[model samples]
Target chain A: MLLEKLQSAVGAGVILPDGHETFVLNLGPQHPATHGVLRVKLTMDGEYILRAEPVPGYIHRMQEKMGENRSWSKYLPNTSRIDYLSAMTYTHAYVLVVERAAGIEVPPRAEYLRVITSELNRISSHLVWFGAFLLDLGGFTPLLYAFDDREKILDLLESVTGSRLTYCYYRFGGLCNDVDAEFLTGAREFVAYMRPRLAMYRQLVTDNIILRKRLEGIGRIDAELCRKYGATGPVIRGAGVANDVRRVEPYSVYPLLDFKIPVYSECDCMARYLVRMDEMEQSLRIVEQAIAQLPEGPVMGKVPRVVKVPAGDYYHAVEAARGRFAIRIVSDGKEIPYRIKLRTPSFSNLSLFEEASRGMMLPDALALMGSLDLVIPDIDR
Target chain B: MTPTLDELNQAFLRLLTPAPALGTACEMHDATSCEGKGVSPNPAPTPPPTSAPVPPCRIVEGKTKGYHFDADLAPDQIVPAGRLLDERGFAIDAVTGVDWLAAGQMEIVYDFYHPVSVLHVVLRCRVPREGAEVPTLSEVFPGANWHERETHDFFGIRFTGHPDLSPFLLPEDADYHPLRKDFTGAA
Candidate 1:
């Protein structure tokens, strides 16, 4: 009866035989390794995780339901809160979908501006992931180094976007305001300064023998598995699929600017780490290119006071720092949406953990989760 | 090489020909014309009186590059159509539900994309609001397990063959489907 109750508690898939003894560990709805309020019910055979199930939604705010009730313009603020780490991309995708549905035209300069700031936000997000992942693996110094670099990007973004973290800058057709020349120069200097600093990161963390051993050959998720699980961003690229939404389904000014989609076929935690590391450089490149090609035009598009989407279903996807962030809006020719869904990247990326972490050591499982770079609120949203 | 929108439409048409007995309904059209015409060649049978008027299925062209194919399928056709896309190497990007309370129907949306060809397809299917159920795509695309569960959590739509239909992104004991139009958070 006790065994049956345990089986019922954490799904039958993780159940042990009648006589065998295995410990079921609850690893956080409030634990540091999880990075947020994410709980993992691990069925362990000694230190090896036989099955891992993640229980999310501690932060669920019903953002989608909130979207339906609020007017089209009123819902803009909620987008950033969906994924605070890459708030710009979330807000950008939300605006793009609404623009597509309402037939609003964004100015060329605004498109370029969106690209620059969004890419900078991507770099900052990757920096956070790097720091948090290393911190999870017991390296205290790299988190400090990663934050120092991230702070520079944040300062650059904050000058224009207003709020540093959960940005609500991107407007319906364009941006809330235009960026200044000082911001451009700071961004350019940061790019030049970051290239060598990345090389130093390779030397400090990437070359560290202990870090290498901890990541290499751990959490091997191949190309097919990634596709099967809808894993995106560095996780899919690390598995050798160059499936970045920026390249796959070109949006904003991504097609105009050129950058490589970093793919490391190793399919391990190290490969994901390297992909993020390489992607920060590529994001820097995109930002540099956008600033060079910056055009002079109005930042905000000439949008009508009352925003109404034609009765239809519209979808838009953007490449966020973690993966593909998509917004699907079902509009009913009114200011308020009939239904709204935010297809967040962290939700799908974290879904793969249960399958990927099975049969792995507990510490390696944490390493795998860290490499996936989940923001639990994003998953909950 | 990427298949043109016409070829993609034909592929879906083939999958739904002589539609199965689950009251399967579908409509096929040229992607560009669907945007302007606002009409389907053969609309689905009139929905039951209790259900709202069904919007004619549309196969509109995607505005963005690489987002080529868009179609509306009946509840039963989703799995077979999904299987064909899975075989063609389209990864399931997301599965979500739209609660059309006025129409008395729940629409399920699935987005898929080809890795190499970069062909994005949006498939939508609708069921009555009272007993919303659609065939699960989890078997066709294993990654859809969570997406379907989340859809279940928000809209209370059931994916017929889903392995695990437990609450996802919601507390286990929560009784309300928060995303439904009728849910006013009064509990």
Candidate 2:
């Protein structure tokens, strides 16, 4: 019955082949491997996947409609909730769009602070991805190590943001609150501590023969496939396209700061893993530079009590941990946006799973999904 | 050397215009002009006290630097324009729908970004509110498939020729589009 439904939904010509006995496997709106409420309907022929379709939307919250219903400033909390793992990036993107549309100038100090917090948040998100990806590969120890580092970062962020996971710290012109000396020192110290730990991680996991055997050259996605599927972040970088939004479309203090985008041409699970590992180090460098060049000014900029965007459409894209996090706002000279569209990278990135997993073994397909680093809520939102 | 923004703009104008020889007369209204009139082609029924005079329709600089190209294409012209952009190496970044309730229209916004040249083009088209329909760009850039589906799920704008316009970020059995301006869900 499920196969018949899938056939009618996806079309008989595309999913099923002639004379091939295949059974459909529902991978879950609840399975542990998916990491969230995401279900992948897999057409399997004895342990090999003939076709895969990801069924998202278990956590759809109508975030865009919420944006229209609420006031301009009231929508900040929803941004973070979309992708809790890298909440800062989402908040930053939302704030930046509103700022640009309203012509609110952020102080240089605020810009630096935003970059520092956002990069730190990137590191925390990558740590979670690292932990979860390894757990998917059956290595339980790495999750502990990854979380150990993630908790410290979260603590540092919580000191200012007031919440650990779904942070709503960024305001339109600046942050909700200012960061103090302790946060800066803790960030710098974390950078120093994390640099060596990355090497330890390399020694412990990246170099392990069994891990390499599992990940290397499995689930290859070349550049063309990435372009077709609109895959971004590590998935595209692993395919040798250095397409980081911070670099391609530089925003805030990223252009002023110096860092390298890690790109690998192998286009496999291992390549994606290495790209993310390298990205965490790059994010560390950004955090270090932002701390070193910290500016002094009022963190919050002057703005009207009631924010009204000039009647126009605006687009702003920021590099979130997962990929290009873009916000499109259409305003009609009102406090509430007429329309709000969140161009989440995870949605585009996760769409590639169907094309990427075809003809691969079930375990290898799961590995590929892990390397994609999906945060399901983001996709559904 | 890559083409300059002006050259790209001119090329886009040439491609989108029904006839290149018609020139400036055939140019669509600038996005700012449409904005001044409250995102409608027609003037607002009752202008607000502070409403500024509408500007002429022409290509103008966007607020964000490097985002130089902004235009409103007719619904019929979007597919050809999208194909031109795809040929020029601009990837589809996002596709979204907007509800212009007062104007009684639904708008589709397509954002395309050129990786190397650092150019961002925003293409917008509007359809009637009751039954919105727009051409699908999934063939030009396959990434648009999911985006179109999401837009459909939100606004109920049907994408002609899309292989699968199934529910994306909504429950499969959802009967009503939630993002339309009129949808006042279980309040």
Candidate 3:
């Protein structure tokens, strides 16, 4: 009898016993580390997972339909809600789309400010991922240690932007407010303080032999599949595709600022982890450049208060911390958009995990998942 | 990246070959009080309205690009164009269906994001209050399966042939779609 263990419905009882000598196992939708509310039915033989089926849609919020009723400027705030961790980066992409749709021009100062906040948000997202990744692997202390620096970053962000977790800072044409002098000085201090501390994150767990054994070759995706699945950010970079939207499709103040995208040939867990860590460093460099070259000008663009973009279609994507976050707006020559859609990276990138998780042991599979850096709220929304 | 208003004004003027109906296009400088209802800052050619019935299309206005007719698609046109777009390397970003209860109509928009050209196409199809069904895009973009289901969950539009059209965001066996205008909040 091949019995299947129902992942979330423990009360409904496990599926018939695999009586296959091996056994079927129930993972979790409730278990703290399934990312968020995801239940998976795994057919296992002894310790190796034979077939791992991911049953998603547990958190599907019809995000697109809501955009239809709202006006273009109103849609900007929704971006931050989708990905709470990378709030600034998410809105950065969204504001660009709205600006393009409405034909608004942001000043040079606004662009630099956008870059600075966006990069800061990237680093912040990576830090949380780093801590959560280690925690998933069963380490507790690093979670606290990582948060120490993260708290400082969040405090800095909150001071200027107003919110900590879900920030809606970027305005349509430009930012909501110009960065004050004290805010800039504090940002510089935070960067200087965190630079050397990152070395500890590198040396402590990333370089450990046991961690390497778990991450090095567990879940391997070839370069070809990466492109096919439209994987972006560190995941695609792990597969050696040097397609960073900042470079390919320059938006905001990215063209004026200088930064490097790190890509590794190894399409495995270590490669992704290393890529994320290096990206944090690159983001720091962007912060420095923007701060040094911070220009003086208005923060908001000359966008109409009630933006009625002439009936047209406009698409814009920004390289967020996770991947390319895109917005597509179709206006019907009305106050509201005929249609609005968000192209999120997590949904596409995380879809690859089901294919990648087969054959690996349960622990190795968890490690591979940690490397993917999924923010399920974003996925669900 | 968006073309500046100035650049758009130029492009729109060029697109207007003969000239606008009002001799010149107007810009709704104060849109907050009024709809940017005026022609535009950029003068463009406005095709004279013909006796032909305006079926499923919207008026297209662009700052730089000339104003033209944008097809507000019918179900028949939507299915094929969706496949063509998916085949042409545009990834499905979202499948949205909006219900205008007061207006007695529902609009379904399939938002497609193409990476190569970095262009987004919003293909819209509307269904009457009686029968709202759009041929499935699930076969074309596998990612659309959940989206269509979600649309069904909200707007009450049936996406026939959707492999698993269960209530995704809502509870199991819930008769009403919470997103529908008629629905009275979370029941």
Per-residue C-alpha lDDT of model 3 across residues B1-187, encoded as one tens digit per residue: 3223344334323433233321211111111101232223333433354454332333444332221222345565556666555555555656666554434556676765444343445566656655788788877665677668767877778887778777765666767776665666565
Q: Pairs clashing in candidate 2?
A: B30-B57
Q: For model 2, how does the per-residue alpha-carbon lDDT over B1-187 read when each residue is reduced to its tens digit?
A: 3345677777766765554422221222322233554665563443332443222123545554225576566666778878877777677888888877766777788888775556788777766678899889998888899899988998899999999988877877776889888898833
Q: In candidate 2 chain B, what residue range of length 10 has the lowest lDDT sum? A: B23-32
The residue ranges of model 3 lying beyond 4 angstroms of the native Cα positions read A1-24, A50-77, A223-230, A332-339, B1-92, B98-141, B156-161, B178-186
Give model 2's TM-score for chain A to 2 decimal places. 0.95
Candidate 1 — which residues are off by over 4 angstroms?
A1-20, B1-4, B20-59, B64-67
Q: Fraction of reference contacts reproduced per prediction?
A: 0.48, 0.49, 0.10
Per-residue lDDT of candidate 2, residues A204-306 (tens digit): 9999999899999999998777776667888889998888989987889999999999999999999999999999999999999998998888999997899
Q: For candidate 1, lDDT tens digit of each residue in A97-204?
A: 989888899999999998998999999999999999999999898889889999999998889877889889999989888999999999999999999999999999
Error of 2 at A126 (Å): 0.1
Candidate 1, B1-187: lDDT as tens digits: 4465567777776666556632344322221122333323334444344444222233555783225566677777788888878777778889978775655667787888776555778887767788899888998888999999999998899999999888877888877798887888836
List candidate 2 stretches off by more than 4 Å. Answer: A1-19, B1-3, B19-34, B39-60, B63-66
* Predictions in order: lDDT: 0.83, 0.84, 0.69
Q: What total of clashing residue pairs does each candidate reach? A: 0, 1, 12
